[model samples]
Target: MTHHILKATKENVHLGGFSHLLEPALTIDSGDTIDVETYTGYYVYDKAPPEFLTPEFVDICQNLPPERKIAAGPHLLTGPIYVKDAEPGDVLEVILEAIAPSLPVGFNAIRTGWGALPQQFPQPALRFVRLDLVHNIAEFPPDSGIKIPLKPFFGILGVATPETARTSIPPGCYGGNIDNRELQTGSRVFLPIFVSGGLFSIGDGHSAQGDGEVNVTAIETSMNGRIILKLRKDLQLSTPVAETSTDIITMGFAQTLDAALEMAVKNMIDFLERFVNLSAEDAYVLCSLAVNFRITQVVNSPQKGVHGMLPKSIFSHKINL
Candidate 1:
């Protein structure tokens, strides 16, 4: 089958929030794969393109209406794709095939009213990162020589719900702006259906990020990536569940850390019981001994998240089935 590619354009992109009422820019059948291009998290605030930034991305930012920059959001999302046969209660399997830089540069920012240490940082600062695509390194300063490996991934991949438009900042059951780095290439994300067609949308690409995302940003950059969307009617999920190269992960979002942690643990327990065939007691015990819970991020207000990780190495039997 031919690969369907969708380029990111001002017409097809949105700022904050998602709703099923928004029209789908593209539609594809189940089991079809699509190539999607996305913008960085700073697309809204970009007044001038950096030296290493590409003209193509600058053109996209320039096309946005002035008011959109104010009300839309900082993150520029690509599309609300209509997947054929996707309906509420079904699961949408998003298989991430590839993630590559679309621009020669990326960026990181520190701003007032943003980041985990907002009180300490009252001023906004922006720093450009030179992406050495060949070397797979994100150089901090050409002279300082600070460098980190490239691990590109889209920060947002969500399905719209039947409710009003939801902001793209905080990730929830719909899967918007979940900055889990594990959702990189070779990962498979399963999102619960909330509306017909799943009204899928994705954007906010990141080159690298740590566990907490405590600074409130990653190697923020634009990217071109491919994903295979498959409709799974036989499965049901509440929040986003994913299997990475090394582990099975379950996610949860809420206002408080305690709540988020509880969500992750409970989801892990459910997964263990359902797939691993462990009894509730056994799963609970195993979780205490094996499951690793991590705070995804604390920056997204009222929607901090945690993910429970169960390593695949523990099982001698392959989980391929």
Candidate 2:
């Protein structure tokens, strides 16, 4: 019922996403509205070199990183907000209300040894992309006449566990950088709690990205977002799950495509068992009949993810939860 506005400050951000001992930036109870501001990974650490940078942009980039550790996967994450009543066994339900560009320009790049077709692009390359926010279009190369529709969303939204620290470059059971394009406005993510109070974090905004993120980047940009954080104490979750207007999604990640697919299938069956009155055998049959598996992202290092999308209309009755 209360609104918590956290204006992104130098101290309010972490360079790489979640860490084992992240300090909480804000603490609030369930049913609270949160207004958050964040920056893209490149904004905080990988500023354009002096030769290619404009004076204005250089100034903006310099103002960001004196306080944090400069590292890769520099998602410029905001917060490890501790939600009241959210313990290790509960679920943190996040409803994304708005995700928009905070700056006038965004960017995209292909590193020397990265991207889906690294061999084709043997050297590093970068470009400053321009976005027309009022018209909802992104113009690459400034005047390339190529206009891409802007569909902004955070690439990272997750909570931390009590285990050893990890990089923001991987998406796993805790949901760091899933990069699923369907996580637009009106979508909601359900993250499983790990440490007590559920230290939820958010960052890595992208104006638009394709399914595979083949280039290893999208319209990389800073964003301002608003969400409703509610603790789902009655139910427990094994991995991150989400609901878009048309589909219910289960997120799964692992080191290989085979492992990721297996996890996705298992999560799908588990979801059916949790939300429906079906036997285990029946749930598996239902998955085979109506579910679709999608690769969330392949760019995140060491781990990849798949999402099992079950159409909302598949259920014969309304979900009681």
Candidate 3:
């Protein structure tokens, strides 16, 4: 397996949307590993202090052309990396090897009309946080003494969809903006490919975030990550699924939380039946006994998310699927 490095630059980054029309920044074969750099917060760049901004971040914010910006969304995503031989109907298995803070600072914000509690808190608020990299903690407020442990992950890890232009704000079958805290290091995300070459992109780095991301933002920051891409023609999946060492995660996104939950549960049942060779009835029973459905995020308006996590330990034998 070859190792490649992708830098977050104005030429390589796409602001706010995904499309098959975007040219691939880099092309690599299946089983290739990429050490990718990602930037965050296109709209909040001006609000960040000069001292906290990295040279790369500043360059991207200043030099990116206006036309590159997608008005419907706010994330600054890196790449539409072409995975060689990855075709439509195939699955791209992205193995997240490692993730780290690329900058010492991050930001969290609550906009006037955004977040889960917008009516109650109408005013906009932004907080700049410093990361104590040595301690693996975020020194929130500098003097508040509230040091939150960093659990960094990319909020967007997705491939191009069938649509020519898709907003980066919501998580969908292609897996954009999935704010699941559970997808940390040593996790594998399986995305169903739509367009050929599986034009993959990554962005919206979060140093730390809660389950629901209730306030509309996390500790948004630049991140450095290493991931291995493998083509899986053997697996036929319609939506994104993930797995860590202990749990298998099936995600669903919809207009309402109840609909998203139902989709997640049904997907989990589908997974158990297809991979574990269990009957539909048995899988439904197993879901009630072992699956824990969680609200992944609520702030990605009109597209809330739910994820069902089934513990791998429940099965006594090995599950290769």
Candidate 4:
């Protein structure tokens, strides 16, 4: 079968939140793979050379309609693709295949009130970064021009939120904006089937980002990547699980550390309930036995967030069926 490909554009849908436009019935046949071209997290802004901040910057930014700011809000997703035969009781496995640069050029910005360090830094900064995927490095000025290793990842990937009109800013059971870095190539991302075909979409590609993304931005860029969808016909996972090149991870995000942990843990509980057939209390014990929580950011607006992981080896029994 021909590989299915989708081009994301501003006209077909809004720049950042394209997943909102997906029809739940969109189908991906078994063994079918897809290539998605994603824009920078700022949408088309990456196409221009870096523009220095000025009073006009804030004026131009603030003058934008509230919804137009940030090119759309945090964590824009691009798909709710239905995996044929996937059902509410089954887990959907998405295998990341290739992740490459869509735009050879990449840029990220820090407006006065944006980012985790905004208050502490209190200065606006604009920068041009190179994500030479050929070299797998992102360069910046340290004491001088310096290059950093690239660890690319998606800032958003999730099933449609349980709430039909939900804002994509928050991370929840259905996996919106979780911001975990481990969802890289060679990883298997398993998500719950809230609606049929386990609608799945992924976007908001980042070239490199520090944990917590404290600056409220990362080496955000456009990318072209491919993923193959497979279904767990009878089994299901409550939250999302990813088996990366180096580890297996489960994730959660929330407005507070405690609440973040709750979401993370609850997600694992749901996984255990579906996969291991454990009761709520047993799932709790299983999570305690298998999960480790990792904080992604403690400073993003509205609330902080965390991501949890359980190594694939944590469970002695082979998890693959």
Which candidate leads the pack in TM-score?
A: 3
lDDT of 2: 0.80
Using TM-score, rank the candidates from best to worst. 3, 1, 2, 4
lDDT by residue for model 3 over 153-240, one digit each (tens)? 8899999987878999889999989998899999999999999999999988999999999999999988999999999999999999
Model 1: residues >4 Å from true position, as ranges? 41-56, 65-72
Q: Write the per-residue lDDT of candidate 1 for residues 1-321, one digit (tens) a residue.
A: 447888877666666768777767689999888988887644434553565345656666667544233234477777888998888999999999999988777778776787788988878887777788899987666767778889988888888887766777888988888899888899999999999999888888888888878877887888899999999998878878999989999998998889999999999988888788889999999889988899888887768889999999999876641
**How much lDDT does each candidate structure score?**
0.81, 0.80, 0.90, 0.64
- The alpha-carbon RMSD values of the candidates against the true structure, listed in the order shown, are 2.2, 3.1, 1.2, 5.7
lDDT tens per residue, model 4, 1-321 = 448876654321222332433564247786788887655544334335543122322333334333322234644445557777766777777788977666655666776876665678788776767566688876676345588877777767777544445555555566656667677777777777776666676777877877787776777766678888877775556566777765556666666788877877887777666656779998798667767777876544565677667666656665652
Which pairs in model 1 have colliding backbones? 16-72, 17-166, 17-167, 17-168
TM-score of each: 0.93, 0.90, 0.97, 0.77
Candidate scoring better on lDDT of 2 and 3: 3
- Worst lDDT run of 10 residues, candidate 2, spans 49-58
Superposition error at 108 for model 3 (Å): 0.3
Q: Give Cα distance to truth, residue 29, candidate 2, Å.
A: 1.2
Clashes of each: 4, 1, 0, 2
Error of model 2, residue 262, in angstroms? 1.8
Q: Give the Å shift of residue 173 in candidate 4.
A: 1.5
